[model samples]
Target: MKHIKFSISLLLLLVFASCEKELDLQPQQSIGIDAATATPENINGILLAAYDIGRNTSPDNLAPLYNGNYSGYLNISSELLGNTDQVSWNGTFDYLRDIFNKALINNNTGALNIYSDSYAIMGHVNTVLANLDKFDDAAERDRVEGEAKFLRGIVYFDMVRFFGQQYNPAGNNSQLGVPIILTPPDVSIRIERNTVEEVYTQVISDLTDAFAKLPDDNGARADKYAAQAILARVYLQQGNYTGARDAADNILQNSGHSLTATFAEAFDTDDNPSETIYSWVITQQEGTNISNTHYATEALGGRGGDIAITQAYLDKFDSDADQRRNFTYPGEGVSTGLLLTSKHVRQFANATPVRIAEMHLIRAECNFRLNSSVGLAPLDEINALRARSSAPALGALTLDLILNERELELAFEGFTLHDYKRTQRNIGTLSWDDNKLVFPIPQSARDRNPLLEQNPGYN
Candidate 1:
C-alpha cells in the first residue's frame, strides 16, 4: 500500500492538480485560490477527492482499518502478540499488534493514519464549503454544500468517538475531543481539542443542514436519508433517545429503502442492495483491500490470513437456525480451524456505510429506552431482523437483548466499539471507561503542533 503525502499546504495544490487531470485539462503548474473555487467541475473534483480518502490504506495511513479488524469484526491471529493456539501472521508489526490488543500507544501508525486521513478529507470538505458561492446554479451549490457537510459530519463523528471519551449527555460531555477544523487552517495554525459536547453539536448542526439541503436522489452519494441515518446515530450516541427515535422514524416513514429478503442477498457486491442507505462504491477496476485484510489466505486468494473470527463471537449465532451464520467459512488461513467472515470475500465488495437495518435497530433501541410504544415495539423491531435470518424471535425485549442483537446484526460494520463505549458496556476485560478504549492522539501529530494536547493516559 502507498501512503499519500498530506499537509494543509500540499493539499491545496494537489486538489487543483488532481482535479485538472481528472477533468482532462492541462496540468496547472500553479493554482490560485480563485481558480480552485471558481468552477463547478473543480469543486466536484475536490468532493471526489474527499470521497477518495475514505478508501486509503497503508501501514502509515489506514483509514479503512476502522470497523473490521480493530472493532473485532474479525478475529486475528498473530505471533507478534504471542498467541500460538490458532493460525497467526508471522510478520511483526507493532502497530497492528497493539491495536488488536486494545493497548494503543501515542505513536501507533494505524491511529496516526486514521487521524491524518480523516482531517485531510475534512480539509477538502472545508475547502468546498468555504467556496459555495463559486457555483452559478443555486441547486448545484446546495447539493455540493450538503454533501460536503455530510462528509464533514461523519469524519468528525469518527474522530471524536476515537480520540475522546464516550458521550455522557447527563454529564455535559466535557471530555476533550479532536480539534474541530471547520475551515481549512493556515499553515502556521495550531489547534486544541474541543469538548465532546461541542463536537456533537457541530456534527448534529452539519448533518441537520445536510439533511435539509441534500437531494433525495443522489445515488451512491450523500443523500437525504444517509444524513438522517447518521443523525440518528449521533443522537443515539449522546443518549438522546427521543431525538434518535424521531430521526430514525423520519427515515423509515419517508426513505424508500428496505431490507433484502435474505441475509445473503443483502451483502451482494454487484449492486447496492435495497437495505443500503449509503456505501463506498467499489468497482472492479478500483477495489478495496478489505478482502486482503480480512479474507486473504491461499484459500481466499489473499496475501495471507490477516484476520479470522473468534469462536466466542461465532457462538453468538444460533447454530440451529440463523441464516447469517452461513456467511462464515471455516478458516483455511493461518487460523486453519477458525471461522472467517465471507462478508467481504471479493476485493471489489462495496463497503456499506449505513443501511436501513440500522435505522430499525436505532428506532428499536430508542423506543425501548423511552419505554414508549411510539412507532414500533422494541420486540417487533428485534423480531423483524431475526425473522429475516430465520432466528427464533424473542417473546420480550430488554436493553441487554437489544444490545446482543446489535452485536450479532451489526458486527464488523464498525459500530461495536462505539456501542460499547456509549452504552457503558464492557468488551471482554476492558471496561467502557478504560483509558485503552480511547486512542491516544498520535505522537507525530503532537510533535508537529505544540498546542495539540495528548489524550489522558498516554505520555
Candidate 2:
C-alpha cells in the first residue's frame, strides 16, 4: 500500500518563491530554505532556471541590430555592406540598455532579468555541483553538473561579447571583462572585473567540463555538441583559428549534425528545421507580442525605423533563382522598399532555435581566417547551399564574397554588428562613430563597482 505523504519542507517554499516573479520581474524571497538545503530535486530546479535566461528579451527578440530593422540603423549593414548611411540610436539601443540595466541590476531579478537572473541560475547550478557527491544516481548527478556548466559558459560568452570586448585570448588577461563569479559572491566576494582572457579561460573550462560530462543526445537541455559548438564560437572570437577549426571538426566528425541543403529551406519560415543543435524554444506566453518576439520582425516593423535592406545584400542573391527574395518583400512602403525579412515572416509563437546554421558559417569563417585555402572549402560549403536554392554558382571565392555571403545568409541573426568587429572592417565613411564600436560599462555598474572602467571609445 502506498503511504500518504505528509511533510512540509522549506525547500519547496524556496523553489516556489524562486520561480515566482513580481510585476517588477524580481524574485519574491522564499520563506523556507530547508528542503533545498541538500536535495537533488531542488538542485535540478536550479539548473533548469539557468537554461531559462536569454530565452526572451528585447535586444535579441526585438532589436534592429540583428533582425528586420537594419533599414534605419547604418551600424548594421555598415560594416557588412560598406554602407554607412543609417547608423543612429533608436529603440533598439534603448531596449538593449534597459534590458541590461533591469535584468543585471534591478533588485527584482527573475526570469525577466537576464543578468541577475543568470547569477541566480549560476547559484542554483553551483549549489548542485557542490553537492554532486551526495546524489545516489551517478548519471543523474553528472547530467545535472553538465547542464549547469553549459549554462554558465553560455552566459559568460554572451556577457563578454555584449558588455566587454570580444575575447582576444592574447589580451583577455588585462582587458576588462565581466566578473568571473564562479560561486555566489557575497558582499566581500563581489568582483570588479576579470580580463577578457580570464573570463574566456573560465568559459572554456566550464564548457570543456560540460563537454566531457554531458550526454551525446539529451535533447534541448545542454548536450556535448552544443557545448562544443559554443566553444567553437569562443575560439573563433579569440582568433584561435586552430582551436575553432578543431572544435568544428570535432562536431563534424562525432556529431550527426549537418547544414541544411537549401538556403530557403535552411532558413525557411516554418519552425526550426533539422539543422538546429540547440535553441531556446520560444514558447507561447500570454501578453507576449508576436511582433516583438523575433529579431527579424521587430527590426523590420518596429518603431525603430532603421534602413531597409539595400541593393547590395539583394544583389548577392541570384534574384531569379533564390526564393529568399520573396521574403525581403519589396514596395511595402516608401521607406520599406523591402517590406519583410524572408527568414522570419511568420508569427514568433513557432518554436525555433536561437543558435544554429550560422554556426556553420562561423566555423567556415574561422577556417578561412586560419588559412585562406580553407576559405575555398567554406565557399564551396555556401555554394553548395546556393546550388540547393537554385542560385547560380560563383566562379571563385574571395574574402569579400564570403563576407557578403555571411551577411546575406545570416542577416538579422545578431552577428551583423559583432561580425563587423571580428573582421576588423570599417563601417564605411557615413556610419558608426567610435562610440558605437564598444558599449560603455554602464554608469550603474560603475557606481556599484568602482573598479570597473568604461570601454575606451565609448566615453
| Candidate with the greatest TM-score versus the true structure | 1
* Model 2: per-residue Cα lDDT at residue 26: 27
Q: Candidate 2 clash total? A: 21
Model 2 lDDT per residue over 19-82, tens place: 3221112224553344454577666655554443323322223221112121112223222233
For all predicted structures, in order, the TM-scores are 0.86, 0.74
Candidate 1 local lDDT, 1-459, one digit each (tens): 111221122334343333211111122356566666677877776786667666532223322322222112211211112122222333356776676676777887667766766776676788788888778899998899999999999878878887888898797678899888877534555778888889999999999999999999786687888898999999999889999999998898888888889887776355677888887665544335454454545555554456555655667776568877666776564657656666656565565547788899999999998997667888998898999989998888889889878877866566667777778866556677788777788887777676788887898
Candidate 1 local lDDT, residue 444: 71
Q: Model 1 clash pairs?
A: 75-308, 87-334, 87-335
Off by over 4 Å in 1: 1-29, 57-92, 296-303, 333-335
Q: Which candidate has the top score in lDDT?
A: 1
Whole-model lDDT per candidate = 0.69, 0.53
